[model samples]
Every structure is written in structure tokens, then in C-alpha cells.
Target chain A: MIPVSVTRDDVAHVARLARLAMSEQELDQMHGYFEAILEHFAKLAAVDTEGVEPTSHPLARANVTREDCVTEPMDRTKLLANAPLADGECFLVPQIMEDE
Target chain B: MNDMADDIGLLNRPAHELAALIRSGEISAVAVTEASLARIEALNPTVKAFLTVTPDLALEAAKATDDALARGEELGPLAGVPIAIKDNLCVDGVLCTCASKILDGYRAVYDATVVERVKAVGMPIVGKTNLDEFAMGSSTENSAFFVTHNPWDLSKVPGGSSGGSAAAVAARMAPLALGSDTGGSIRQPASFCGITGLKTTYGRVSRYGLVGYGSSLDQVGALAADCVDAALLTAVIAGQDPRDTTSADVPVPDYVGELTGDVTGLRVGIVRELMGEGIDPEVRESVLTVARALEGMGASTGEASIPHIDYALPVYYLIGPAEASSNLARFDGMRYGHRTKERAADHIEMYSRTRAEGFGPEVKRRIMTGTYALSAGYYDAYYLKAQKVRTLLRLDVEAALGQFDVLLSPTTPLTAFGIGELVNDPIAMYMADICTFAANLAGVPGLSVPCGFTKAGLPIGAQFTGRAFEEGTILRVGDAYQRATSHHTSLPGLLGAGG
Candidate 1:
């Protein structure tokens, strides 16, 4: 069963974890949506998965490894072309270190 | 020659037939390409199937194919055929938006493996088609840009997240298109648009350079005018690729060559759970009709119960979003895609604002759902439980397939819904994928073929699902059904009236 009713606080907390900035209105909306979706998912609680092993990848292939060799990478200019802000060679972003 | 070209009905011909015409020197590839472009110009305004139309790229590729043919070079199987790709698949130098603002201004630096394969076979890609944002949601209404309309009726949606690809083929904008199926994205849309769509086994087709949404569940496949064209395109794109480790090492079958249309003595199982209750009467009737047709072809049919079938929707919702949250993490403000214009105090603010601004409501909701599911305290209750249920679903399918050559069901519970009808209700929209999602969860091949039309003139599709690596069998069944029925050949009234 869905143990907890999704609150605005829960939406806010999850939104933060997902790096999303939600307004109060959006948070309330998300909370309702989450509650409904989670309630729908609550049906799975009835299935007795006593000794069932989880299947992540549908086709069970093991250790898809490749040769440890270096190959030519994509052109740096082309790779960086889509960057929102780039400083010629690297992506430009807001300050990483806060004032201490 | 020009008059002959004009009368060729270029848009309605199958991809293989178009290629054959080009090869035989009856019509130039340039003429065919121009004809398709003209159709796109005429119909795309109403259909909204394309996110980006690359006329120059299409014409250039078509000319090259003609040049190769003129030089007496042996052409590939799909040579000179016009195709469209769902916007999520990367095509080098073309805008590859997943119908989300997050990917605005982002052009892929390289082609997806499927794109490379299609290009290698000389298929001229006319454009990138629209889809739901990051391939989330069941209808193209989730598209950040615009919703694609069903060709059969302009007021209704072409089902999604491969809506545009399906609509493109259905409207005769293109003969073949590629769509990725993660929880029935391809088949559902094909069903809605009255075309053929194949969702290959998980490892059957390479997913390299496909923008990830539910990584484990995703398989790139074809949406074509008919099952024969679908099989031909599948053969060109299905072999193992070193770039994608999940692509199976199994030898690729000549899917076109396997279309002997012989399903005599094939054991067909109709999943009782999928047909009862919630399914619309017309949709259910179409499925039954297809079953009867199969029985007439000397195939035996029986009711098969997959006890866990009802649980598939909840399982898919949990698992699909969980993977999507992880896969979509790359689209922060710094590297690529949309970045917020507002000044931010620090990097975190920029990241938050960028994501908030870039992603659509459905995409954001999915990310939140996934984050919540994978959160520390709830992991076992939701994500893990969903995975375990997935195992049960797979086992249930396996047990059913053990007794039957293929399982059959309606592709969608209903015909194409009117746009905006279910857009506000996410649960109602999610329910549309019920019949198709189980195949994805079980890692099997499923084909959607046009079965019949609703009295309202909307298309209904029946799904044929085969066990793992049994695409040939399913295609054979689909082919035989098409041979027996005229539903696949019937064009939407919109196409005839508009043209």
C-alpha cells in the first residue's frame, strides 16, 4: 500500500533532489499528481514477490565489455557547439565555489 | 517521363517498390524526393508530424542515390526510399529535439547508429518527426512544441510518443519512419494512425545514439506503410552494432525474405485479460475479427490467460520514470540544451532553473516520480517492487508463449482519442498503453497492424506479439493477415480530400 500521503513538503524535497525549481502552485499540483500515481502503483503490493528475482535488463546478457583501447573522440568544437555558454574550448557555467 | 512521374502515386507506394522503381530507371530518385517534399509541404501544415524538414539533405541524398544507380552501382535494399525519423534519434547536423524545449538549439554532433544504417542503405531522410517530450506520455499532446494530429481525423491525436512518425507514414508524408518503443510508443501510434509498427525485442536493434528514456525498455524500430515495408526496414537496421553493447550478437535475419505469408498451423493465443472490460467494443471487435481471419488461414486460436497482465501499467509507470530520471540527468544548463536567462547566485540555481525552464510538465512530473521512487526510503517499496513484478510479467508472458506461436491483443484499449480529452488526466493517458506495455516489460517483439476502422472513421490496430527473437514469426503472421484483409491498404479520407 502507499504508506504516506504525498505532501507539499515531499514534493519540494523530491523536486530539490531532481534539481527542479517548483513554485508553490506547481508543488501543490505535483503533490496531487504524485498521490494519484503512487496510489495507482499501490496495486503492486498485492503481488506476493516472495522469492522473485528482479529482472532489470530483459535479455539476460552478462558483462558486455569491450577491448580496452583508445579511439578518436568527437571533434571538440562540434561537441561544444551546443553548449549554452562556452569559452571557446570548454563549457562556461555559474560559479562552482560559493563565497566563504 | 514527367507526366509518368506525376501519376506514379509516389507517396502511397511501398518503400521497396519505390526503391525498385528508382533502380529500374523508370523514375529518378530526385523526382520521388521532390514529390515527397511536396506532400510534406501540403500535409504537414495540417498534420504537424515533422519537427524539422531537411529538404536540402533529402534532395542531396536522393541525387547521390540516382548518381550511384546511373553508374551501374548495386544499391542497398532500401535505396532511394524516403523516410522520416522520430526526433529523439540523432541525425548529424540536424536538429534532434525530443519534442521538448530542453533540446532547443541542440543539433546532434553525430548520427545515431540507426541513422547511419538507414543512410548506408541509401534512404533519404526527409525530416525529424515530433514526439512526446523525451518520449514520455502516451499522446503527442505532451509535445512542447505542437501536437501532431491523426491523419484519419484532424481533431484526434496520432498516439505517441512516436505520434509524428506514425502520422507521417499514415498521411503519406513518408513511406517509412523509425520510432523508438518504450512502453508501446511505436505500436500505439501505429495503431492510432493505421500503419504497421514493430517493437523489436530489447536487444534486437541497436540503441546507440538514441536519446535515452527508460534505457532498459527502449528498442528502436520501424513504422511503415505495411508489414512488408516494416520488415524490409527492420532488416536494414537490426544487426548488432559494436557501439551499443546491449544489441544482441545474434545474426540478423533476412526479415523481408522471411515474409512467405505462411501462418498455417500457427498457434495463436488471445490474452483474455487484454480483451475484457476496459477495451472499447469496436477495438475489441477488430481484434476478434483479426483472430477469426487468422483461424480461417488454418491457424488454431485459443483464449490464453496472463494473470499478471493488469499489473503491467503500474510496473511500466514506476520503471519507465525511474530510468528516465537517470537518463535525462545530462540535460543541465551548462553543457547543451536550454539554459535559463535569469541571473543565478550559483551553479545549483542555474541547474535548477535550467531544468525547470527546459522540461515540459510531463517530463518534469516523470522526473519527480522517478526521483521519488528511487529515493532512499521508498526504493524497495516502489522501484524494486516494480522490478520484481517485471520478472513475474516476463515469466507470465513466457509461460503463455510456451503454448502459443504468438499472442494477440488490441494495440490500444480504444481508437484515437480527441486531442485535449485526456491531456489533463495523466492516469487516463497512461491507461492507453496497457495492451502494448507488457510486450516491452517481457522483452518480446510486438507488431501492430491495421485491423479495421471504427464507425467514426478512426483506425483500430491489433497487436501480434512473439517470444524473444521470434520477430520473423510475428511478421509472417502480420503479413498473412494483411494479405487476407484490406484494412492496411485503406487510406485516410483526409489524404484524398487534401491532395
Candidate 2:
């Protein structure tokens, strides 16, 4: 069950930590949303996974073998044809110039 | 013969028959492509399913297929079929935004391995479809740009983050679509939208061009109106690729040839943990119906417990978000994606403003949760603990699989809910993956097929999961169940329904 009292401040804290700039209205709306979410997550607290060791990956299988042979390269012209901003044989970028 | 014309008119015709028509010169590839496009145009707007529709490209590809056939060139299986790709898949020169604002303008320079294979076999891509932002939520409402509604009912959600893929196939917008399942993205959506979806073993199919979410759990799968079509698409795309490091070295089995629907002497386990508590009664009945159907088909069915199954959702929340945070780190509004312009600011300021403006709310939530879980003080307590627990969860399935060929469960606890119902409650949204997440955690194969519909006409799906690399078992079970019933054959009453 999610908590009913989750505040806009809690959502703001989370947004700041996430490096997001949310408006006050969005924060107010998100508080009620987060509260419901926390309640739903609270159900997991009742679940007992205490002694069970947590697994990161499901596969016990490993050691996929592969040949080290080099393959032909994809045509560079074709590869870079779709770049939105490009220079001659290179991708262009905004310059970070100093104004001393 | 005009019989070819009538045959091509049927939207749900089996793949093999459609292939025969194309090969025998009775139906041109262009005809099938046009039929699919016309169907999409007729229904897609109401459904809000497709993000992009590539009519020109599809027609051009179809013309190329017709030219090839005219020259006596051999077309591979599923030749000339039009299929849609989930926006998350990289299609060179096409937008592959994963349905997010951050990647609004980003296009891939290369095709994903699966996309390349399908194209090589002469399948034309219809377009990219909608999904949750970075394939995160259980409903497509989380999509940054649009909400894809269930074709069966407009007010209800089509499950996510592959909702558009499932809905597209359900709406007959495409004969088939490829989807990636991370904690039930493919199967849940399939169940909700009433189609056949398969989540192959983690490495069974190459993940070369799929934008990463949970790398270990995500496997590219297929959505089709029927099992045979699903098998047909799976055969073409399932194979080893040097580009994706995790792609299996195993030989690609003749999946099409092996669709015999014969499962005599095979052991099927009904996971007891999944049936009780919170699951809708209708979903449980549907699972039991399929189990009984399989049992009658000479497969022995019994109840088995994967005790740690309930912990899957919790473990997934930790692991999926952690991986997502890291994977999405590349989208700093630097290379390509929606970037906010900052005046009188340094590089860091530009980066911060761009990211803040680009990512949606759910994406931000996951990134924060992931960052906290992997942060200095909490890494040992949360992230490491979750990884260890994942191994234990996998062992639970291993223990059960020791006695059974496959496990059975309701693909989702309920059918499609109202769109905003779970979105406001993120935990509830996460809970939607409870039944399907275990297979992702264990990196095994899972398939969801429409078993029955609820009293209100919503679809209920039954999932069959198998041991790693034993996709044969899962497919066989699904084939057997589908053969025994007309559930998978039934289509949404498209009379006034949205696609």
C-alpha cells in the first residue's frame, strides 16, 4: 500500500538528486503519485526473501566461445551517412571556446 | 487464379500459406504490402499505436521483392511480409528513440542484428512503433510522445513497453512485430492486447541493436496473431551474431519444421506461487484452462513451486533500474537526442539542462533509484544484495525445472487496466510484471498466448516458461495449447474498435 502523505518536498528531493528541474505544479502532482507508489512497494516489505541469496543474472551458463578472426569493415561512408551533424570524415560538435 | 486474391485478403492467414501465394506468382509482394498498409491506415489512428509509418520504404522493398521473384531468385521464409519494429530497435537512418523525448531526433547508423536478418530474408519494415520511454513501464502511457490504447477497447491500455508492437500485430497493422521483453514487456503486452508473444532465452537471439534497458534480462521476441507466424518470424531472427557478445553459440534449430504441436511425455509445471493472491480470477482460470488443455494433449501437468518467485518483482526493480541508469548515461544531450540550449553556461550546465529537459518523469525516477542503489554507501546493501538474490531466484527455477520441462502461469495478474490507473502508482505499475519477471531474472525463455477472454471481453493470456536454451519446449507447449483451441485465432471485433 502506498503512503497517502508523500509530500511535494519528497518528490523535489528525488528530482534534485536525479538532476531534473521540475516545476512546482509537477512536484505537487508527483507527490500523490509517489505516495501511491510507495504504498504499493510497501507490500514487498512483507515478503520474506531474507535467507535467499539474490542473483544478478539468471544464466548459470557461461564461457561462450568465439573465433578471433577479423571481419571486413562496414563502409565508413555508409556508416556516417545518417549523422545529423558531421564534418569531413568526422562528427562535428559545438566548440567550448574560452572568453579570456 | 483469383483464389490468390481472396487468400491475400484474409489478414490472419497463416504465414506458410501467404508465403506460398507470394512464391507461386499468384499474389504480388506489392499486394500484401498494400493490404497491410491500408489496414493500418484504416485503424491505427484510433488505436494510437504506431509512432512512424514508412509507406514509401515498404512499397519500395515490396517492389524489390517482386523484381527478385521475377528474376527467379529464391526468397527465404516470410519473404515479402510487412512487419513493424518496436522503436527501441535500431533501424539505420530511421528514428530509434525507444519512445522517449531524450532520443526524439536520434536515428541509428546501423541495423540491429535481428533487423538485418529479417531484411535479408525479404521482410519489409512497415515502420517503428510506440513504447514506454526506454521500455520501462507496464503501460504505454509512459511513452513520452503518445499513449497506445488496446485495440480491443480504447479506454484500456495496451501493455508496455512493447505495447505498440503487440497492438500493431493485434490490429493487423502488421502480420508480425519484434519486441524485447524486460520483465514482461513483450509477454504482458501480448497478453493484454491478445496476441502470441515469445521471450526467447536471454541470449537465444542477438541483442546487437536493441537499446539497452536490463541487458541481462532483455531478449528480442516476436508478436503475431498466431503461433505459426510467431514461429516463422522467430526462425528467421533466432541465430548467433558476432556483434552481440551475449548471443549464444548454439545452432539455430528449424523452428518452423518443429512446430508439430506434439508434446507427449513432456513435463509441465504449474507454478503455485503465481496463482494465489492478487491475480484476477479470470486470469487464473485461463492459466488452468491452458494447463488442462496441455495435459489433455498428452503432456503431464502438475503444480510445482519456485518458492522465490514472489521476490522477482523486488529484485527486478533494483536490477532493471540500476542497468537502465547506466545504459541511459550515454544520453547526456551530447551525441544525439533532445538537447536544451543553454546560454552563458559551461559544458556541465549544458549537460544538466539538456538531460533535465529531455528525460520524462518515470525515466528520472528510475535513474534516481538506480543511482541511489549503486551509490557509495548503499551499493553493498542494495545492488550487491539484489544480484545475489537473483542467483537464488534462478536456482528456484532450476530446482523446479529439474522435475518439469516447462513452467506455467498467468502472464499478467490481470488484463489491461485503465491507462492512468497504475501509472500514478509506480509500484503498482512495477507489480504488473510480477508473474513474468522471474523468467527475465533467470534468463530463460517464456511465451504468452491468448488462452481465453474475460467476461467483459478482455483477453487473458497463459505463459509457458522453459529452461535456458529449451525454447523448443516453450514453443511446443504453446503450439499444443493453440492447436487445441480457437482462442489465438479470434481477432478483436474491428468493426468500430481501435487498432
Candidate 3:
């Protein structure tokens, strides 16, 4: 597969997918950054990786479970301390749902 | 003081020796803490090594150790030895920004498991060090705070994302500092700053409280003035943590005691691919010098190849950013950290604006690249293929290590470059890590030692990659090498105080 020549639209689409707001200048700058990075990835495209396993993690372990028991949770006050907008014990964020 | 450790005052002394001085009552822990704090106070403005200095915490721990010693109680091994913590690790109520604006005004609510362990041992806490924003770049220039200057030359960068920690130790502001490695973050800076740095095997240390970067590749380790100091710190922080299931149940070795300084009868492999082409001629010669010295110590040397290691840079860029995109997804203007104040119409708008405002250019670039690679129609072409190639790299490394006790290479292609030299050409900056990234990709332990310096007076480093969970072996080579050579003894003539 040939490396896709990422356009400003592609950069804009990716940034939006990443939930990052960017000015036109930033998007233009990122277009160059992505072009260089993708060009580097072209070698990986040529390499034959058939029958190879993907390593999601270095260690080969999973399902780390413990006996269900009551335990103290992180202090609500402390957890809320860095919240940009906090309401008593909860984090206040922009409304997610609209009234029907 | 011992002969090798002579000339330099209390601050230049290694942490283990300082602990011995305190234990013998020849000096009080408070004096040691004061010396370290004084050094930081005098030089940190110029070096920009530390983002926060905890004098109160340092003195409090010192006093406690002094009280214990006065009562005729046995002193802890690292008692009153001041250490700097990388800001990415939580330190409970202390600032824990990964030198990113995203985490500005944020303080940790609990100690990272590593910090808790350090405090439990009663070592004085000096401060939090700076790094690349979210550990994203090759230089501390990405830090929202300030760039950490290499002690050797003020104009050069201390390589990141552990630049601040490496700078602190090189300037002798702290004898020990903890840092995390994902890619060449720890070793590359250690080489540039001329300190002994050890990047442990992925499962050798806990990551419970470290800020997530490339989760699979990240390992907490140390930067120090010498091999003994490196061994002392790595030993204290390493062990299986139930909280981090990925941490291995392997028994932590007695790193200091096991440093018998004997590389005799062991085979050392000079990794051909890591030394040729892109590597500087002087840096390659410095690595060859280490191989020669080891040969003189009765160890035999030979050429070795990992075959697939040449592809590590592209593979690392792919995998690290992909994982980073997922690991860092939590920074979405919600639970904690910086949130935008601009009036917003909806949730996505708030998150987008907040990240755009908070993240640095490097961070934004990475998040975007990762999103693109993992998005529809491109996953197989990029992310998945990179992962599969990672397996090839790992197997090749395993095969090589199976043939030799350790593999040697230059830590970076060259010594420290001027501050803005490669910062503009991102790919060029990534090339600096050519010799070191494969260790992270392999999840193996690697140690960088001061090999030699260039005619320009900048330091060069030789790295030894050990088999998984075998930090003691590479450390043994580093310890033996330091005992024979005085390169590790040299420090920057910056502070206008030491030596």
C-alpha cells in the first residue's frame, strides 16, 4: 500500500476526531508534520509481516481479578480539587444532553 | 571521603555514600539535605532542571532520619539521600505536571507507588523535575515550563523527556532522580547529560502512579552520577506491585552487592546495526572503547545483528503514538487538569478548545497522527502492521541476547546538539534516538554509561542491553567500567561551586 498523501482536510478530519480544536494556521502546520511522518511509514508497508502476531503489550498476562470486597475509594474532595468546574462533590461539565 | 569521590563537596557525592556518612554520624542527614537544596537554589534558575523544590519536605525527612540515628537506631540504606522525582509521577499534594500546560495548576492527590516506597525508606525529597509535555518530544523544549540546559554546555539541550532529571543529576543538584523511559527518553538524555542511567525491563518496576505515555514501553528507572548510585536507586524502586499486574513476580536482585565488577568469562556483542551509518564516528569510537575495555577485563567481544532493528524508528513512531492516543484520551476537559473557560455550546466543543489551548505542538501532532492511523481504513496499514513488526524486532533481540550476555551500542548517534538544531525537523530529531529506541521496543533492560567525550567537551555514551529482568548483568558491566575509567567522575563546571 502506498502511503496516503494526507491533505489539510485529512489533517482537519483527524484533529476533529481527536477532539482538538485547531486554527487554520495550526492545520496547515500539521499537514507538513503528517506528510513527513507518513513518508517514514512507507517502509513498514513494504515489509512482509504475514503470520506475525501483534504485540499490544510487552507482558503476556490478563484477567487480574481480586476478591470482591469493600474498600475505601479516592477522597471525593481531593478528586474534585482539580476539576475546572466542581459542584460540591461532583465535577460539573457542559451539558451533554438536550431537553426533548 | 574516598579517593575517587574526592575534590567535589557533599553535593557531588553519590547518594549511597551520603547514606553511609549519615549512618556513621560523620555528618547529619540535615546537612546533606541542606547541601543538595543549596545546590538547587544556586543553579536551578540557569539549568531549569526542577519545576518545584520541596525544602519543607526535604528538611522534614532529614530531621526524622536524624532523630532515628540519635536514638541509636539503624539508619535506612538511603536515609537522608535527597532525590528528585520526575513530575509525571504523583507525589500527593505536590505538583505533578508532565511539564504540560494541560496539567497546569494541578496537584497530585496521592503518592505514586514509587514515591510512597521512596518516602517509606526515609529519603529526603528534593523536588519535581521537568520533561517534554506528556513525554512527547526528544527535547525538554516541549516542556511548557522551560528547557533544561545540558550542564556541559549551556546552549545544548538535555535530551528528553527525562531531560530535567538528567540535568539535575549532572549538575549535582540531586544525586539521584527517577525517570520513565518510553523510546529513548531516559538513556538518550543520560548520554547527553553524562550520567549513568538505567532503564529497567518493562515489568521490573511499577507504573501504578506514573502518568501514562506509551504504556507497554514505559519503565521507571534512575539517572545517577555513577553505576553504584544507579544500582542503589534501581534496587529500591523495583519489585512486583499487585496494583500493576504487568509487574513481574521476579525477585529483585541485590544490585549493589551483585556488582562484583566482573565481566570476565561473559560474551559482549557489539550490535552492528546500532553503530554504523547514521551514528557519529566519534560516538562509535567511544562505544568501541567500552568494548575494548571490557575485552581487557577478560570478556570476549563479537559482532551481532538484530536484523529487524533498523525498522525500529518507524515502528516506534507508530506504536508509541497509537498507545499514547489511547492512554492520553482521558485529558478531555472533564475529570481533572486544565479545562477551557470559553463559553461552550456542547461537550465536544469544550474538549476540543481545552486540548487545543492546553497541549503543545508536539502533543497535538502525536494525537492527530495516532487518530489518523487508528481511524477507519488505515488501521491495518499502520497501527496493526507496526505491532506485528514489533514482534519481529523482539524475537530478533531475544535471539541475539541468547547468543551473548549483553549487546553494546551508542546511546544516541551523537552527543548533545544545540537547543534548536533538530527541533524543527521532527524526523531529524527522531534520528538522534536511533541507537536507543530498540531497547524500549524489546522491553529489555538497558544502561548508559559515560564512555568518552568529544573534542568539543561534550560527553558520549555506550549502552549495554541486557536480557529481560537482568538489570544486574548490565549494571555489573557499568560498575566495572566506572571503576576502571574516570569519565563518570567528571561534572559540568557550571555551578561555580563543586570542584
Candidate 4:
């Protein structure tokens, strides 16, 4: 079992980190679900990887170097034209709170 | 009127016939475009296959093909044929939703490499097809927008992430459609919908501009009415693109030519593990027929055991979700996607509110599962063990290929289950991928061809596996079998009947 207790406040905290806004109903529903998820992951904590090296990719990793070259980019006017809302030459966004 | 019905029908005709028609002036490129759009309008609603339609642009492209033909301009194969692109692929001026609400309104500024190559060969884009939200589920039921039903049985789901593309091709809404296969997204749905689908080698087709799922496993492939059409479309789009770092720089051989090569003297392996367990009897019989047909063509067939397949489903669950958790981090609502608003709250609240509202339950479940798997103290047990399992599974395929040129199995355990049968339980849903998951873990190519129909007339697909970069071999055998049999040619009656 997951040793950590996931309180409603904890749910709200992780939600904030994940950028999810949960209603009280959702938070209550997820409380037990999150606990179950944590327990499921707790199964992984039992494996021994003391000396195993971590691999990020299955294929060979190398710098994908490209020549310093110049080429025509797609027309910016055409590209940004589809943005639902835009400012002068850039996408527009609603203001976020300073703390946010 | 241009009176190019003869010419255009050539566009919609079987690839070989279309090739002959193109050579004979019986049809022009423009006629095919009109017929495809007319079909799309009539079928898309009942099937919910397309997320966006581009008729005006498609006609313009068709006219260009006609003008070029008049000038005696040499057209490449697939000229003037209309093809639908899955919504996951970036099409300039079209919304590349990946069937997720997060990017619902986001239009691509440029075409994906595959899109660019296909257009260069004179294939008009009919539209963007629907898919699971971020290519997540087996059933298109997880799509944020809507579900794409099986053309064979409307109440059932088209196996998905690429369901809409498969359904479009199956319904004859479009002769061919492009789909991205991350897990069994293409093949499983192709099985369910009664169409031919191919998951090319990981680097065989460029992934540039494909919204990343499991970046290591995803591939762009074709869903078509038959293997010949699949081969034609695959040939045009299969090539290395400089923009995709993982793309292989190998030369694309003439897949069409390979189709005509003798299948005699080939060693075909039927993976014994995928059979004899949970496989519907009808689906198993269909797989057996393909084996018998291959043996008749002078190919040797026998059972090969892949012991590690038992571990494949679990490994994929771990790796797929782990990668998904990381990749989906980019959709934080600030990057031109669905963003939630809050009043007088901190930055954390802003993020929590946005993601909770934007993501569907399936997406959230995966994200949470992945986050836990990657969290401190849990990493070694869950993530590390799964990686080792993935390695073992890959080695199984490597050893099997040492003995056989290709491996065979039923594409899915059963034909299309009812729409709601497996939706409620996530683990049950994940288990449906038991047979097909091994290929993704092994990073190899797999193709699903319509082997036969169940007594109820639903299609069963036989999957053929090849070593990396050997899709030509699979297509060759599939095309040969299709030539000797009428299974792939048998279209679902209603889909082919006029809308």
C-alpha cells in the first residue's frame, strides 16, 4: 500500500501542478482513485535497480547536427492568420494573475 | 463538364487499374477529386470519420494535376488520387486536433513531411480524419470530439487512434487514408473495420509533424481498401525526411515491384503464442487460411514460439504511459491550446483548472499513472523493470526473425466487440492489445490484411510481421495472397452501396 496519505489538499496541490482545475465532486471522486493509482505504482517500488543504468532511448543517440544553412521559411502571415486570437504579429492570450 | 469520369474513376479505381487508366487517358485527375468529395459528404456524418474537410483546396490541387497532364508533365504514381489524412498529421491550414479538445482549434502552419511528399506526387487531400484523444484508446470512443464507428457494424467501434482513417477507407469515403500507428492503432482498427493497414518500420516513414505519442514507437502508415492501394500510397510517402531526426536514410525500393516478386522459397512463421489463447475461433480460422495460401504458393509455414509475448502488454502499458506523461506536459494551456481561466488565484491554480477541464478521463488516467510510475522511490520498481521486459520482448522478435522471414498472427484477439463492451474497464481495454503490443515494443513493422470474414460478415485481419525495414516483404506476400483470393476485394455491402 502507498504509505503517503493523499488528502483533499494534496489532491488540489497535484492538480495545480498538473494544471487541472477540479471541482469538489471531482476531487472527492479522485481521492480514492489517486490512492489506488499510488498503490499500483507502489508495486514498482519493490523492484531492485541498484546497479542498473538508465537508458533514455532504445536507438543510438547522437547530436542531430545540421549544416549552418539558410532556407525560406513558411510565410509568417499565412501561419499566424489561423490563430483564434492574435495581437500584432503574435498570438494573443488573456492575462494571468501575477502569482499564476 | 470535363467529361473525365473515365479519368477520375481511374483515380478511385484499384491502384493497378488506376495506373492503367492513367496511361490510357480514360480518366483525368480532376474527375477522381470530385467523386471523392461527393462520397465524403454523403458518408462522413454517419461514420463521423472526418474532423475537417478541404474540398476547395482539393479541387484546386486536382485542377493543377489536369493542367500538368495537358502540358505533358510527367506525373508520379498516385497522381490525382484523393487521400484522407488522420487529424494527428499536420496539414497546412487544417486543424491537427489529434481528436483532443486541448488542440481543438489549433491549425497547422505547415504540412508534415509525409503530407508534403504525398502532395508532390499529386494526391489531393480530401480532409483530416478523426482519432482518439492524443491517440490514446483502442476504440475511437476516447476521442474528445466524437467516435468513428465500424463500417461493418455501426454500433461497434472502429479500433483506434486511427479509427477515423480506417473507417473512411472502409466506408469508401476515401479510397485511402493516412494513419499513425503507435500501438495497434492502425492494424487493430483495420481488422475491426475490414480494411488493409500497415505500420511501417519506425523510421521507414518520416514522423516530422506527427504529434508525438510514444515517440519511439509511433509510425505513419496507410489504411486502404486493399494492399495494392496501400503499397502505392506507402511508396509515395515512405522516405527519410531531414526534419525527422529518427528517420532512417535507407533508399525506398519499388514496393510495387516487390508485390509481383515470387513468394516461393519464403520462410513464414506463425507465432504460436498469439494463437491458442483468447483468439476467437473464427479469427483463428481466417489466420489459418492465410497460412495455407502461403504454403500453396511454395512458402514453408510452421509455428515459432515467442515466449516473451506474455510480458509485452505490461511493458507497453508502463512505457507508453510513462512517455505520454512526459510528452503531454507541453499542453499546459498556454501554448495555443485549451486553457482554463481562474480569478484571483496563483499560477498553480491556473494550471490545475486548465488541465482538469481540458483532458478527458482516459488521458488523465494515463497521466496520473505515468506520474506515479516516474515519481521518486517508485521509479526503479515500475519503470526499470518494464524497460528490461521491453528489451526481452525485442530479443524474442530478433531470435524469431533469425528463423523466419516473417511472422503471422490474428491482428486482434476478436472481431469488433460492441461499442460499450470494453470501454468501462481500462485494464480490459488495454488487454485487447495483447497480440499487437509486442510489435510496438520490438520496434518492428506489422501489417494487417483482411484475411477473411466472420460468419456475421465482420472482417478478421491477419497480421504479418517483418524485421525492421522489411515492409516490402510483407506487402509482397499480402499482395500475392490478395491476388489469389477475393477476401480483400470483398467490400462491406452497405459501405460500397451508394450513400
Best by TM-score: 1
Candidate 4's DockQ is 0.33
lDDT of 2 by residue, B1-499 (tens): 2233343355566556677789898888888888878777767888878998888888888888999999999987789988999999998778788888888877788899999988888888898999999998999998999899898888899999899999998877788899999999999999999899999988889999999998888899999877788888988899888787788778888876777889899898999999999999889988898878787888898989988776677678878888987888787665467667655256655666777788888887777667655766656656776676678788888899999999999999989999788776677688788999988998888999999999999999999888888777788778878888998877787633221
Mark the 10 consecutive residues where model 1 chain B has the least summed lDDT: B1-10
What does the lDDT read for residue B286 in candidate 1? 87
TM-score of chain B of 3: 0.98
Candidate 4 regions exceeding 4 Å error are A1-17, A24-58, A71-85, A90-93, A97-100, B1-12, B496-499
Candidate 3, residues B1-499: lDDT per residue as tens digits? Answer: 2322232477777888888999999999888888888778778999999999999998999899999999998876888899999999999999988999889989999988889888888888999999999888778888998889999999999998899999999999898999999998899999999999999998999999999988999999999989898888888899999788889889998999989989899899999998789889999988999999999999999998999887898999998998888887899879888889897888889889999999998888888888888999889889998999999999999999999999999999989999989888888888888888889999999999999999999999999999999999999999999999999988787855435
Ranking by TM-score: 1, 3, 4, 2
The best candidate by DockQ is 1
Q: How would you encode candidate 4's per-residue C-alpha lDDT over B1-499 as one tens digit per residue?
A: 3433332333335654664555456766667777778777766788889999999878888888888888888877777778899998998888888888888788898889999988888888999998889989999899988888887888888888799999888877777899988789999999889889999987889989898888878889999878888888889888878898788878998888888847999999999998897899999988999999999999999888788687676567678888888888888665467667554255556666667777898888777656655767656666777786567678789899889999999999999888888887766787667888878877788999998988988999999999988888999988888888887766666544222
Q: Using Cα atoms with residue i matched to residue i, what is each candidate's TM-score against the true structure?
A: 0.98, 0.91, 0.97, 0.91
- Tens digits of per-residue lDDT, candidate 1, B14-131, equal 7888888899999888888888888888789999999999999999999999999999999887898999999999999999889989888789999999999999888899999999
Whole-model Cα lDDT of every candidate shown, in order:
0.91, 0.81, 0.89, 0.79
Q: Model 2: chain B TM-score vs. truth? A: 0.97
Point out where model 3 deviates above 4 Å: A95-100, B1-8
How far out, in Å, is residue A37 in model 1? 0.7
lDDT of model 2 at residue B25?
A: 89
What docking grade does candidate 4 earn? acceptable
- Classify candidate 2 by CAPRI docking class: acceptable
